[model samples]
Structures are given as C-alpha cells and as structure tokens.
Target: DAAYLQQQLQITLEEETGIQSTQGEFKFMVAADAYEETERVKVNYTSEDTLQQASTSGTQSDNAPVYDSDGSTKVV
Candidate 1:
C-alpha cells in the first residue's frame, strides 16, 4: 500500500506546485522497511530544474528590442 500511497502523494504534489498533473514527471517509492501506517515515502521530482532553465532563457530573450535611426528608445 506504500506504493499506492506514494502515487496519491504525487497527485497531491501536482496540486501544490501548480505544475499541472500532466506537465511534470515524477518518481515515487516507499523509503521504509515495508508498507506500514507509520512508514515514510521518498519522492524524486524532476521539473523544477527545467522550469528554472526556461525562466532563465526567457529573461535573456527580453533583451531583444527594436532599434531606431533617430536614437530614440522604445520597448515593444
């Protein structure tokens, strides 16, 4: 039942992170001797890095701007 519980926890995680249930990838496993009422679970989430990288790349693209011959500045 630990594996099942882990899966349930993963679902709950998607709600908390706002990553969308289908957008992120997850791997969960019970990190205990067995499936017990007081057992602990281990989860490996692999999306935060991707999200961070995307945001970093997006910021770099913001530097692009239109140039004017009159030396005027404008953001578009």
Candidate 2:
C-alpha cells in the first residue's frame, strides 16, 4: 500500500508542479477513528531548482505520442 500511495502521490505532484521527486523516508502516524476505519494518504514533495530546470528543458516534447489517423483516434 505504501508503494501504491507513493506512485499515486508522485503522479499527482508531477501533474501539479511539473517536478518529479524521488521517494524519501516516509513516516506514518495512526490514530483510531471513532466513526469509520480509514487512513488518509498525504504527500509531500521537494525538488531542487536544477531538477525543475532540467524538467522544463528536457525531452518532454520528444516524448509525446503521435498518431496517424484520419481525423479520428483508433487504437488497434
């Protein structure tokens, strides 16, 4: 569950900030719920300015997918 949460958090952070962060140490604090039983997943990300610059000027455009279709998107 930690791994899945980490991946989801990474994707969400990247989409929001355009920065990717490696998973650092994680700490979990659990408290008993009175009504329901569920734990919230919270994510924190930190990236250096160099990483931001690299991501901005990196191969993002080159990594875009191109499709050859007649005004329609069809997957075969």
Candidate 3:
C-alpha cells in the first residue's frame, strides 16, 4: 500500500508543468502532449524511489534525481 501511495505522491506534474488533475489523473494531450513541451521539468521522484521517503525517525532519506546515461530521467 505504501508503494501505491507513493506513486500517487509522484503524480505531481499536474501541479508542476500541467493542469491540475482530477483525483490525481491528468490529461496528457492537447491536440495530443506536454512533457517535451515543458522541457520535462524536474518533478518529484517516481514511486520507484518511494524507498527514499522522508526520514521516519531521525535518519534522512537520500533522494536525488536519477538520470540514465543518455541524460534522461531514470526515475521522475
């Protein structure tokens, strides 16, 4: 359930680069899209990085943007 919740958390592009979502779901097309349109702005890490959640007690979590060799985001 944590993973699912985390994924929901990552659904933030709607607030960042696109229009607000309806229950976390958004429209990803105009005449047809927007990621490339917005230059792929840095949003929250994807649910794949949920393990990097904020500190639970006193330890901090390391959450840095991960990029593939091609310089594209690996998790975002």
For candidate 2, the per-residue lDDT at 49 reads 58
Q: Number of the top candidate by lDDT?
A: 1
Clashing pairs in 2: none
Writing each residue's lDDT as its tens digit, candidate 1 over 1-76 gives 9999999999888777775533443222332335542433322123666778888999888877766888777797
lDDT of 2: 0.53
Candidate 3's error at 4, in angstroms?
0.4
lDDT, candidates in the order shown:
0.64, 0.53, 0.53
Task: In angstroms, give how far residue 69 of model 1 lies from its true place.
Answer: 5.7
- Candidate 1 residue 23 Cα shift, in angstroms, is 39
Task: Estimate, for each residue in 5-76, the C-alpha lDDT of model 3 and write its tens digit.
Answer: 887777865465445454235443551256654543433444425545544422432356678999897654
